[model samples]
Target chain A: MIETFRRVLRRLGSVETTSVLIVLCAVIALLGIFLPIRTSNWMVLPFALLMANLLAALATNARLKSQSMLFAFHAALVAVIVLVGLDRLHAMHGRVEVAEGSMFDASAVAAEHGLLHDLRLGEVRFLQGPFEITYAPGMKRRETESVIRIPEQNGGWREVRVGDHTPLIFGDYRFYTTHNKGFAPIVTYVSASGDSRTGAIHMPSYPMNENKQGLAWTPPGATKPLKVWLHIPEPVFDEAKAWKFVKPTNTRLVLIDGDERHELSVGEVVSLGSAQLRYDGLRSWMGYTIVGQSMIHWIAAASLMACLALLGHVLSVLIYGSRIPAAGAEHGG
Target chain B: MALEPAPRRRRRSHLIAAALVLVVIVAAGVVLEKMPGSGPTVATAPQQSASSGVTPFGQAFAKGIEAMRLGDAHTAARAFDEARAINPHIPEAHVNLGFAFLAMQRPREAATAFDRALSIDAKQINAYYGLGAALDASGDRKGAIGAMRTFVHLSDKKDPFQRKAMSALWEWEAAENGATPQQGEADAKSKPEAAAAKDAAAGETTASIEQQGGAGTGAKPEAVATKDTAAAEAPAPSEQKGEAGAKAESTAVAMLDTARRNNAPVPPPLPAIADMPDALTPPEGVISIVNVWASWCGPCRAELPSLQAFAAALDPSRYRLVGLNVDRDRDFAREFIRDTAVSFGNFWDGRGVFAKARFQVEAYPQTLFLDSSGAVIARVSGTREWPADAAEATVAEILASGQKKEPK
Candidate 1:
């Protein structure tokens, strides 16, 4: 029974098993990205199995105990695999589009996080400020600069300028600016109780559907939905020259009711059903991709150590093997 | 000692490996637990109300435009009437009013507004075309033919409505007689077209009108939008946000202001040194302390010698120190350094240009501390005493896999 168990453990930890697991993981990851199937389970199982195999090898390999360089190499490999498991357990990845002059509330983000993801993102408070984008002659974007405001210990917001090259780093999370920004209109709905709620209505990807800009808004305590459309008076982008990213200076909100038509300009207010709807103004929104991998630094260090150990093992084998064979040949002769 | 202690040696070797693994795990756990932010925040608080701040003309004109856009004949007619009552010379208002009346199937009223617009300007293509369509829809056969003929004569070749006018003329001519056109005049020519077909098709009447005047139906909003000089000249909302957005405003303007107020230029010329690397970017896995100072500043004068001493005592491979002298007087700055008898990489910055623009430094005698990865660890202001051991320990603590230490 002990011999059978020993053979089974050795077989599972063999190089062949690890190679098969790696190939299987790669295929499943590709399927997860391209196919509309639940392939995450398939991936997790193999990676978990591979990590167990590495651990088994560390415990049972008797030669690795005597050979210090080989032992260190295998130990480094174990460390790397363990870090990968920890990363999968705690990593988070998500995207959020924050409107200018608006606070980035963590709960509002649509994100995917690992099971053990720590949800204490409130330590760094960020208020998105107005961003600027420069365009080439044909309206091709050349540069993008997003300004972020962080709360200072002394109570005022400290400005941090972030561009494509300069990413905002908070803890293990890194925020990169992507080419996914558009315009957002500030809409205020004043209820019959005189209570007002202000929110940003982000448009469908801009220039993607430049002619269409609208949203359906229902005031508090009202059953009927108000039909709202953004009535821009001019071309947002000029073909002749570079233009600044500015909200329509005279954006008009066209509201439709039952046989009633109302146009409210920027800073305009009018009555709707039992409430007063105000078009406070327009603002721009910026998109950001946020990634959290807390164990990446440890993984990188482990990888470096693994490479060094492998080098040491190779050198030791070359030197000692050559010396022993030559000394034996001379003695035999 | 070596031969008798095999068990002890094995235990000691195991202890080292165990300690390494434990240290790494603990460090990773601490870093993840203390990282800034983990999720989104909920913003549900009510904001202040936007009070009455509309211009009488802007509001009324906007109402007229929106009503027209919505294809609401009665509401649009009332809004346009209000606008004309306020100022009797807006020809666009009359043209839009005619469109509204025509959409309502009030041909006589539509014809009257269209005629009034033509009288104001004979070349008003919309008025001429609308008059012809209105006349045809009202069953006035001869009048419709004549009005359409006039419209075809007066309209430009590139006018979008010209081709529609010709097609409608042929149909009206056929309708006058007993010949049947492809589409009945009652179905095609009687209705005004909507720019956005789906949105305007909310009502049966709007859908009908939307089909008749299909000129601006697919046209861009900029083409359909009237060139309202009043609206064009009005101040943008961003300007208005300046005073109202006191809690926040444009970041560019704020950045510019900070740049202007930071470090001003000093007089006299400072000599350039060849020893220091630009920005004092330390090599990988090494800590760097960049001290920015000016000769005229009293705090900076006092802090130089100790920093030099501390720099010399630190392990060369792990730590580096650079000094930035901001006095423009090269001789004076050089003399100050010589008199202090300090050694370490030092460079001359006569105007505080690099420090102010890049690091947003607002004061003299500022020191920037950096970690091994070249990330800004912390920036200390005023004067700091850097005894070698204390600085080294702090750097090591920062490098450890644990909770982030507050920058000194």
Candidate 2:
């Protein structure tokens, strides 16, 4: 039994084993980069083999133990690998549209996250304020600056400015602004039973879907929902000249309810049976990309430290003689 | 000296490192769980009412309303809060508290109070209005408009607060339309003389139609809805001038308001006819009877003669009768109209825009009754023999039902 275990350890600790594992990891990584696979599952076996090889080398190879710098360098590399795997398992990416003067709702986010990602987004509370976006001639969008209000620890709000490049960082999550924005028609529906609900109907993306700015919505306690379209009678801004994004004027909300159509101005109400729907006004909604639980910074730091330690080890080796003689014969050198 | 082997020592150190990593991970998880803002909180309110007779709760509630009416907002707020503490389920206390907060110029707090009131009883109409006002003051103009619109929607037409809410909502919405709030206010306050002149003209037209009908038949037609009891008992037409005319007009308006509150479905204007020809356009400022027809439908072909006779017999000054052709081919519809010798101006629904899906035209030869503002207020389905006398009475009834009055 002892001989079998010893033989296994020797094979795992061989330099050939390390080289084979490294080659396998590199091939898998190359495939991941080139192929359409989005999951990290395919690389797990290669990583496990590399980790096992590192552990066996630490156990069976005496040269690594003799040099502290070399050992620290390899240890940092192991830490980097572990942290990267952990981050991949826990990372989350999501996108959400929040209207101005409205609180951010986590439930409204369309998201994708790793299986191990702990969803604590609901805990983050903030209100989005008005955002400004400038457009160059020919409708090229520029930088967006959005203001947000976050509650402080002691019963007040702190104003934070977030832009395209600058993210609103809250604990482990960061919200970055995106170019996707459009008008949201604020409306209120009052049911016959007196249940009133107010919500914003986010129109299709501006300019891109300018011609087809309509959606179907069902009111509370109604059997049938109506199709509502925002009709801007005239051009909001000139695309030929540089302009800023602003709400359009003289807009009408056209509602099509089975065999009937009603065009409502702002503050105009239309009755659907006993219930009523009112088009309050319009507000702009900003789209934000949310990233959470990423360990990229830690991984970068560990890699840099490992590189420095490797340099130090190389310098020490050139200056000094063999430390308890190199285990070259055992390594098959 | 007896010592452990180098491999054994290394293996032990590896085990120790692995254990340390596991411990660190566990510690991190525990810390995260115990951290503040990690857990979500659920709001709970007492569902059942506790008030029975006059108690401290009643006294506090009464005090709040009295203080509010006296314009002592601070005192009202305190009393409402006291009433809420005594019985948290009372929605009125929360609504009054919201109003009090609004009076205090603390809109955010007022919004919260209104929200709480809504949670207790969603039917609290005043809470929605207060919430809108609070949101507007707090710079959430959209939310304010939503709340006020909902209030107007639920409130009775004669509710004193209804006018105020509508005026405020118009001002806010006008501001959104690139106009100053004051400009919106001014626009809302001003009533056009043109509208009054149109009403007067409409009254004269109805009276002339009545005189031409030569005796009233009390038979209620489907096209002329007199759903309100008061509308049925309305006074007969009399030639009153000046002060008497103004008083009659006021009475007519009140009766119309009551009829509107009886859940009358007011259809909006048809989609813009940019693609359609100008000949198809119905004239504005007069009641229009649009007769929908298709060349293929036998009933539509049969009704063409009666529609022609009805149009010829009607006084052209008060009412305009037009024909909507739903035939796929415009030439076919024109040829059919020419064949029938129908002189009325005909519009071809070539795009099928005025098909069964649009105007609920379940059958061919359906007639739509459009008010002076071009809103389709009523409809008459199937073919009917156009007797000049019955047609005049129908027109008179539609006019008397306040169809000419613009929707509020």
Chain B TM-scores of the candidates: 0.35, 0.34
State each model's CA lDDT, in order: 0.59, 0.63
Q: How does the DockQ of candidate 2 come out?
A: 0.03
Please tell me how candidate 2 rates in CAPRI terms. Answer: incorrect
Write the residue-wise lDDT of candidate 2 on B1-408 in tens digits. 899996678666656544543444445545554445321222222122111223576557556644543336688689889988988876667776776666566779979988998998787776786688678778898897898889889975754345556766777787778775543443344322112111221133223213222111111111111211112233223221111112121222222222222222222222233355343334665677888877667687778877778888888876789887776545334434533456787666764565454566656778877765555676667776776656777666655665443331
Give the Å error, residue B82, model 1: 9.4
Candidate 1 lDDT over residue span A180-288, tens digit each? 7777767788776789898877765565445345556665678986656565556688857887766665565656553333545566555554466767877778888
Interface RMSD values, listed in order for every candidate: 18.0, 16.1
Sort candidate 1 into its docking category.
Answer: incorrect
lDDT of 1 by residue, B1-408 (tens): 347575456445645654554464456656654655323323332222323355565456556544543445578678767866765554555665666666566778878887887777676555666677667667676786788788779755644345445766776677668787654453353231211111111122322222322211112212212111111234222211111111010111111111222222112123353333345667787778878887667688778877877787778898888787776544445434533455676778666766665556669898876665555677677886767667677555544635343332
Chain A TM-score of model 2 comes to 0.83
Candidate 1 Cα lDDT to native: 0.59
